[model samples]
Target chain A: MSEQEFTIEALKQILLESAGADENIDLDGDILDTDFEALGYESLALLETGGRIEREYGISLDDDIFTDHRTPRALVAAVNACIKDTVTA
Target chain B: MSARTVITGIGVATPNGLGVDGFWAATRVGKNAIGRVTHFDPTPYPSQLAGEISDFVAEDLLPSRLLPQTDRMTRLALVAADCAFKDAGIQPGDIPEFDMGVVTASTAGGFEFGQNELKKLWSQGSEYVSAYQSFAWFYAVNSGQISIRNGMRGPSGVVVSDHAGGLDAIAQARRQIRKGSKLIFSGGFDATDLHLGLGRSDRRGRLSTSSDPDRAYLPFDAAADGYVPGEGGALITLEDEQTARERGAQNIYGEIAGYGSTFDPKPGTGREPGLRRAIEVALADAGVEADQVDVVFADAAGTPQLDREEADASSAVFGPSGVPVTAPKTMTGRLYSGAAPVYVVSAVLAIREGLIPPTTNVELSPEYAIDLVTGQPRPAPVRTALVLARSYGGFNSAVVVRAAD
Candidate 1:
């Protein structure tokens, strides 16, 4: 799979696993537009997700990544961009 | 007047089990979780065996945000606290922000994390140090992080009285609830089997070097030599009776009926008065007679001398061969600051299920003449339990828990 696809899949799996308490949000829905808060993820959960992504991909994310990308789709895109920039450099 | 404090919910991340149900099930059947150390290569250490929680995956347990900033110890604490809050049916947003509190006990705060950071600093450079290096090992970090994560804004504190602090944390929770806090998260946990932590245990000369898992921690046994290091912790929700009633909190485990603590500075004697006195005081505080206690959850220090002291103390308080005694720590090993709360959990389970969990990895030592429940679970009406704990460095504590009314 392409890096983007992998990132998207990874993000979805992480959300699906962590978002057990919230029954309102559909896990199969478009993750890009889904607000994580609506899915029962507060700041702590989001930060933990970011940390896992950083460790798995071997990348250091900007501290403000949560502010920059509030949804899983945006987070995956940002991560893919980070990997691309690192590879190109 | 102090409010009546009762344990409304319990959560545990033990080597034997991850939650209260699993933990109780394993304890009920006398399942031991000790094994060859997998957290690190055990070849260099004196003890090759430990009660390690190898199956816990932090990312799967906690939020992604907490993964980088916390250590295994804190992760265990947070997960246990989360379970406890769910068990209590409490939502921080639903209650008054200042009505809840968090109190935890710890002997070594994030020792594994601190050890790695220090290695990086020495082997690489100052620049290699992680930003979390400073806060990771602070003993109070567990209480602080739990409060922050749950947005609990009431009184918070951490007890550092070695393993004995586990019982003390619960005592403090009752005190807090009496002082007007509606609910308090109380108990203790530790993950200190890293090289640094292990080296300290090695220097103390109390860790069992036995590579065999079954023989690793034989508390109250004739062959008992020393304890094997264990990791994990327990956290329970203690709520004021009125608050629990008001919130419609069902599933009450038991009440923190009474507590007492004493210290013994002189270490050489095989007999100690402090443990006995603590038990006596605790029973008196609860207004219960010695014969009324259904079972005594021993400290089960596993050292030959310490085990003798604990047995003698029980004998002194409850008469010879008194009130079915058990030490389920033989199953989970001693988890330092996490030990007593886990014992408290076992006692509560015994009370709830009316069966005393057996003491595994032990042959009744003829030396102490104590009637230890072993081999299999003993069925009896368990109404009250007295849990005991003693720190290696002289702190002795006892807490009395009774079936919730």
Candidate 2:
């Protein structure tokens, strides 16, 4: 599938698979510092999103970018960087 | 009533095997459970090998009423707890609910459940996802579900110190027992058996990608780079000495003689000072000196630096005198929260059997100098055993187990 075919829903799927959440999650969702229950997250949920994005998208986010990327919108931007890198490579 | 706690029975559903008989047989012979992921299509993933508890059938373990509400981790706990209660000869209805409490550890909560729901929502939309999906993926999900299912009315809690929380939960159990309680169920189980948790660790570059199964989890080895994530559950029934004797249900795996825990301000230097301190505290708590420790169960984390920290802390406590140390977990990938109880079980068996299983795949090391067991298991008359664990996030727990006298 082309990069254009990957919608925000597709991106959400990638996020959900990689780190463990969905587009229904607050793009401004505080997945790192906040109580996941208040944010409606439980049981190894975030890991699904984190795993998929790193493996499928080829994004090597190993340097503690979690501090700045507190929200899903910020996470999306970071993910886009990985997408950019993958497209360029 | 002398508040001494003993593991009356143990039930395990781990990557190594399904039940206690299977688990013990696999572990005693030193079998490796690492393999490519089969539960999901892991073809596109970075790390191919993991210690997956793929053999477990949940409905086989959980109560019919509670099965619908429990997570995979909870299912593992319920099954193990049942085995433990039965192993101790404690029937479900026979035990007093008010006297029993559960202290457990969890790292992932319900990643799989959440992932499945998200899949339905992403593919068929939110309408396809079940409303009960809300309860399946939270950290407290397992503890609450297990307690309600088993009718455990004592203290119920879940520790969150990464994987170290597993061992730490047991430490709290010991404390509660010491402070005054009848029977305590203390153990932990974690399942990140999903792409999300796996992705996070992979993105953080924390897991081993070496395709070779046997060579994947080389704990304390020089080339040991990272751990391969895994899942499983272990539980034990701890009863007060008098209470156990009065009921005639005391096989006594061992006593939770002493327990200690500490936190390092930052992940800097070998957490030796803090770990050494915890060791000292546990030894004192158990009323035993360092030399009396016959065998040491090292949390050979399969991460180079962490392993070194553990080795140094141990050497400082035991003082260079080769106190036979073993990390049987090399056979299974580090279960994090699942590691401590599993190690404790091995320690209990080591005390019972007078043998320390070998540390699998330890070719060499970079700094720490505690005699690393390699190739095969070592037989020794272990009177006392120490299980030391340190978490990557924050938490160091030490438990001392003595030969049941």
Per-model B-chain TM-score: 0.97, 0.94
TM-scores for every predicted model: 0.83, 0.78
Query: Which TM-score does chain B of candidate 2 obtain?
Result: 0.94
TM-score of 1: 0.83
Error of 2 at B50 (Å): 0.7
Question: For model 1, what is the alpha-carbon lDDT of residue A57?
Answer: 68
In model 1, the runs with Cα more than 4 Å from the true position are A1-89, B267-272
Interface RMSD of each: 7.6, 12.7
lDDT of 2 by residue, B34-119 (tens): 88887788877878888898767775544343444456777787778778877888776676787778888888787777778899
Candidate 1 docking category?
incorrect
True contacts kept of 1: 0.00
Which portions of model 2 show Cα errors greater than 4 Å? Answer: A1-89, B63-65, B267-273
DockQ for the candidate 2 complex?
A: 0.02
